[model samples]
Target: MIQSLRLATALLSGLVFGVGLALSGMLDPARVRGFLDVTGAWDPTLAFVLAGAVTASGLGTALARRLRRPVLANSFDWPTRSRIDFALILGAGLFGVGWGLSGFCPGPAVAALSGRSLPVAVFVVAMLAGMAAHGAARRVLLVR
Candidate 1:
């Protein structure tokens, strides 16, 4: 029963997220690229979307703090890391580079897959490969 509820919640949340992305023009690589172009013809749509996201996140965090546990989960799965490290910085840098170059962050890229775009498909494939490579490298490093 709980598992079904969790699955339903996840599906609903993803649908909401994908719809929001599509409506906000986030699924468009050109729009995203325009937003990233600070010195060129910049678009402020991404900023508005980001502001909305940040506000939602802040509200959710506040509500979570007031609750004993998540509504659909046993407990909160908060990040265990508190301090920034070299690996964190490197990962962030890599993520930024990929986003800037492709204009398709993970969420939007995945959502864009519904459009059946070849470029989006390529981006998703590359993103998955990068993730797999990172996992493999991490395992190797940990084993060293």
Candidate 2:
């Protein structure tokens, strides 16, 4: 019963997220590039998308902390890491560079794939490969 509820919630959340990405023009790589262009024809549409996401996340976080346990999980299981570490900073820098160059972050890239775009497909494939490589490297390198 609990597993079913969790699955249902996951599906619903993914659907809503995909709809939001599509409706907010986040799935468009050209729009994303425009936003990143800054001095040249910068688009501010993504700012509204960020604002909406932050607002929703803030409210959801506040409500979640008030709960003793998650509705679909045994516990909150939030990340333990809070400090700004070297790995975190390096990873973020890499992510930002990749997002800027490709005009597609993980979520937007995945959502955009629904349109059957060849570039998006290639991006997703490369992203998945990178993820797999990272996992393998972590297993061999990281002690924690």
- What lDDT is reached at residue 53 by model 2? 94
Local distance difference test scores for all models: 0.95, 0.92
Q: Tell me, by lDDT, which candidate is best.
A: 1
Q: lDDT tens string, model 1, 30-144?
A: 9999999999999988999999999999999999989999988889998888999999999999999999899999999999999999999999999999999999999999998
* TM-scores for candidates 1 onward, in order: 0.98, 0.95
Number of colliding residue pairs in each model: 0, 0
Model 2 lDDT per residue over 58-119, tens place: 99999999999987788998889899999999999999998989999999899888899899
How good is model 2 by TM-score? Answer: 0.95
Q: lDDT at 108 for candidate 1?
A: 97
| Top candidate, metric TM-score | 1
Q: Which ten residues in a row have the lowest lDDT in candidate 1?
A: 71-80
C-alpha positional error of residue 95 in candidate 2 after TM-score superposition, expressed in Å? 0.7
